[model samples]
Target: MNVVSKIEAAAPAAAVEAPAERMRRVVAVAVEHGDAVDREGRFPAETVEALKRERLLSVAIPAEYGGEGLGTAAVADLIAQLAQACGSSAMIYAMHQIKTSSFVMHGTGSEWHRAYMRRIAAEQLLMASATTEAGIGGNLRNSICAIEVEDGRFRLTKEAIVISYGNYADAILATARRAPDAASSDQIMVVIPNDANRTIDRTVVWDTLGMRGTCSDGFHLEAVGNAAQIFPKPFSEIAAQSMLASSHIYWAATWFGIAADAFNRAQAFVKAAARKQTDGTLPPGALRLAEAAAKLQEMKGHLMAAIHRFDAAQVDAARGDDAALSSIGFAAEINALKVAASEKAGEVVRIALLVNGILGYKNGTPFSVGRHLRDTASAPVMISNDRILSNTATLLLMSRFDTSLGG
Candidate 1:
């Protein structure tokens, strides 16, 4: 089935509004304010409000928790559509879903997380993540800070390197060492609500070239909550099982959305140029447009394939296949998807810019692709393609590549 068919099939039986329809309304708001959000370097408040109104935040949560229980394919499709409207908004939405997936897939064993999922559905609360830390560099698995437990409560102070939409999030999912004396890699995921008991002090400004509206600034996050807020599983298992795959898939979808928008603008410019030409002559950029289209198609194919693999793994995992989600081949494939999508997204946007020529280079024009290009440029460096490649290389060394067509 096609992506749209899969999304429709995955929708809840009792859903009042289809996921696609709700996204259309949200996309309208995102497109309307995308420029202003980018120019001001602030959060996409209006678009987020639309999301809350549409209740798309809880679409990934299970139906048991008042959610739609949509699969990864459906969520990725929605994210890509939103990215075509606004990169920052789409990214914010993707991050929220990524964090929510963790709770839905891993936190159901605990009552606090189960109740929080219900609250997310009822209240449409936004979630942010704080996995990157100061001293650890870009290694998310290691953390210097640890959660301190006392009297059935826990407290943690993390010098987060970057927290996207941190201030606006209703709750932040942070990673830290399991105990004061535990190894740096012995980490746990904690859900810290942005309430009176928590404090966030901005330590770094988030003025960047692209995706400025994300407001991904560094902060000193100090929060206290019940011990039950922490997930029972170690951070490593959670990352291997859900977090890594979800992050790569959703993020690639977001990049594909941005690049797709650029391709659209380029196609429009080509058609407009064709209209002005005499005889049956094609525009100079027509060839380039075809090339960019191919690259975009390839990017989409990679993303869709990854989504299918992950969805299948989820099914197998549910069927009691313990290694379905954590196999060496699966991990390498997902990591490779992120690397390919990120790099190809930049290529597609850059080619689109060339197709639009000077019009696309400018900031304000009917065929301008500056925003798309800039936004896509951040994809490669978001998690640092180099870092992912290194990790994937290690994984590949231990596993043989599957060359079979149906493997």
Candidate 2:
């Protein structure tokens, strides 16, 4: 069965159609434009439009806000399916969901944020994030910009080094120091609606080796909004409780999708080679195909395990056990998932290319894995696997590893 079919079979019936069914058209649109989007380093406008038309963008929002109220696993699956068709579109969607998760999990307390959630659902708005700054050097936990508040309104000016698809976002979630005198680590997350009060000045072009359609250019961002637009919780708490887990899980799913597609192409090439033989002998690449398939399975198992752990943690967190979400073990495991998935994705793609040999090296053939390789190549550096490992190593120093399977 196909990915959509699996989603349909596993999902319980609801009043609205399953998100998987809706994603079918989106995947088709993405596949149609994936090559051009990559070639021109442009946005996947058609694919995003299909998502809006199907109202899939609001799948992560709560039901109270005119959304479907789907859980994390469901959204991750959809992201993986989209990634198989177009990596850039899938990353764009994944990043949007990460930003949406912050609002769904933390923004409902304030009336202003609640209303914004409603708007996000009702209008199918897309969200971008501005956490990486010029001075911080990819450290989201620290910020040089500060939000200036006066007379119940606030203003912020940030030199963001990378805001993925910022020009096309309807709103942006930005991080900044809580006050002018606050420590760089003391931060807040504010919602900046793309209105007349907001301006994005392009500062750097996004010409990269892979995942070209993301348009992750640098910008000078200035925005004004009511103080109420900010979340009640600190950015640190928000990152621990929602953003961190969601980003890693969903991103791993995207990489998995890219790897899965590459494997599929490799399998096709192997099968074709086998068919050409009259003695019923397997192709020389068959053993390599088997090895790649095993690695792919390992990657999927790791992602699914992380998803279940995250869901269980969310349940505990909802029951007032904040420690469940804040535990060092959980954080370390999620970080490991990102590192493993990123590395394994590149490995699987490389194996697939080896299986297909010269054909996989080409760009326009049915067995081509060139785009898949390019796209997966960006996985490790997205958050920098080295940085994640460094953080995980620090976490491990404070906690003991659990050896039991049940644990």
Candidate 3:
């Protein structure tokens, strides 16, 4: 069926206008202003401000802490919807949510952490990740800096490869060696609220092909906080349970949003073409649109399946280094989904571009898909799909799953 037919026969829209309704309104603002944000390489501050007004920044935090207390799947839906309007805004939001969820996941037994969570909920404070280091080569599991302690106070300094929207964040959640004498891989996470002597010092410029509104520039972060600010839990657990897992899920959602936008555009083009013809024939480009739609459906299924699996495992609330998740092969499967979703999202956008032909290549037109095309191009390389596949290759070699019917 064509677009109009689908809508006429469509299932009922929500009676009360669900939270996604608010997100869609935020998306409309993003779609209106996204071009300016991308062209000037400026942060989507206005779009972000609108989302904050909607209290979306705290959408995933627990209710006891004054947030919406939504689940990972729900948060993923929000980000995907946001991406349909503005890729930069969605990604920036995704990173902030991932960091805040990290704060919630592994931070325990510390009164400071509890207070901080309440403060984040109250303030709707945006969070930034200073995880990627200058020399870590994108390995979040390793960090070269160490926290130095004197009396009950601790200090840390790190050369961050990129801190997305660093200037706008109220605080940064960063990783460091567990102690001055700890190994590079033995890391601890601590929050450095934006305060005196604790601002992110920009060391490099940010100019990129797409997702430019993120303002992801290099920075040198230095800060001092009470030793109690440090999470008692290991960084490994935080990364495994919250950072990596949650980020992958949310990232895939936004990617889907971008692709969905492209697919919608393509659908409009095909619908118009059909309307112009008396026979209501399928346009030559209709097949490409079909492929894009199929890929999008596949992407959503793959992502949500893995997400619900994690939820069922209750692994997000599991304590300690979370070595059990890896032992049971959940980590490997999640990584595989990340790889597949990233690659497939890009493909969907590419097919949509093909369906739209030269119009999609143009900028600033109703049918123009340049922004969606550009943003989707960055999907696969954001976390380096090659690295993920390489890691999963080892799992494939040493482990196997039962594929028998009804087994």
Candidate 4:
């Protein structure tokens, strides 16, 4: 029998708080734990725990599975809002949403996946992805590991160069060569549940300058499961439709949130100084604040325009339609969004630091912009802007010109 045909209700029977209320509480926990998670390079366990308890982790799953069934915009808003409190926490959340898209889009009508989705909604289990391989050099399309099948069961051992919050994840969605002897680019996404019968071997140490709480480091992942554990669809469709666009949207949203924090701080600093003057003279940095605000608006416009374009397809925006998603132009635009968000986030942090003078540089204070500056500085280099530009160059070559939008 197929996994989807097994048995059970479409949605779970469990009850939980509303998503916004749940997120507010989780953000508070993340804010409380943010400092220590960064300073000591530890995981944001408190935030993760709150997320589980509040059942907000399943917000990305379909409501039929007893989840919130939130759309892409709502998910983006949630991620960006959380980022204002903690970058690592938001990054972890963003990854979970990205992984969820895979199952949400492809798992439909599958008996095994339906049950798994029910489990996720009821248990609030977090997911981590091991798509990046050391040999592939950050390319999600290439995999050095291959799955071996025997007796209706399969086993694969993958080297994950960076599995963010790996230690805390309840399941992993991994990519690998389709078969033992398949080409590296012929890949499939496999679901490996972190259950008692399955085992994963990992020893990763992450100590970074910023976004320290993510604890994203190397891991040796090994697991065995029924062949049904593999998604029925190919990874390419998953990538073009959901993975690529969702990743860019969620990630860029979080970066925008980070920049928003810095902008708010800068504006507040200027306002406070302006209030102290008897003559009501505006502070010098007030002009700088306005300039940063303008830049921020532009940044948001670029990101949102791309998001709306994707939304225009009118099919389940997250799952994505083939013809709309396959357009080289759309792909190029998505890549450009990543570049803009990453670079603009860094610039906003710098503006915040400039406005607050020594106070923004100080640590352990509400007025301090040190942490924001540190984390935002790493954004542009996370996926490496150079790589994005190189890939976009090839796509732009064949893209058509629309004179209206800077053709």
Clashing pairs in 2: none
Candidate rank order under lDDT: 2, 1, 4, 3
Residue 122 deviation, candidate 1, in Å? 0.2
Q: Which ten-residue region of model 1 has the weakest summed lDDT?
A: 5-14
Most accurate candidate by lDDT: 2
Candidate 2's residue-wise lDDT over 1-407, tens digit each?
Answer: 85344433533442258789889879999999998999999999999988877888889898888788999889999999999999999999999999999988898788998898888876778999999999787899999999999999999999999999999999999999999999999999999989999999999999988899999999999999899998999999999999999999999999999999999999999999998999888878999999999999999999999999999999988888989788999999999999999999999999999999999999889888888999999999998999999999999899999888994
The sequence of per-residue lDDT tens digits that candidate 1 reaches over residues 265-377 is 99999999999999898988999999999999999888888888898898898887849799999999999999999999999999988988899999878778898878888
Range of the 10 consecutive residues with the lowest summed lDDT in candidate 3: 7-16
TM-score for all predictions? Answer: 0.95, 0.96, 0.91, 0.92
Candidate number that wins on lDDT, 2 or 4: 2
- Model 2: runs farther than 4 Å from truth? 1-15
Across 50-138, the per-residue lDDT of candidate 4 in tens digits comes to: 77766678887888886888878888888888999899899999999999988887788578888888888776778998898878867
Per-model C-alpha lDDT, please?
Answer: 0.91, 0.92, 0.81, 0.82
Distance from true location, Cα of 177 in model 4, Å = 0.7
With a 3 Å backbone cut-off (N, CA, C), the pairs that clash in candidate 4 are 3-111, 3-112, 4-110, 4-111, 4-112
What tens digits encode model 3's per-residue C-alpha lDDT throughout 29-145? 898899999999999988987776566777777777766678888989899989988899999999888887776765546788878887776666789988889888578888999
Can you tell me which runs of candidate 3 are displaced by over 4 Å? 1-18, 315-328, 402-407
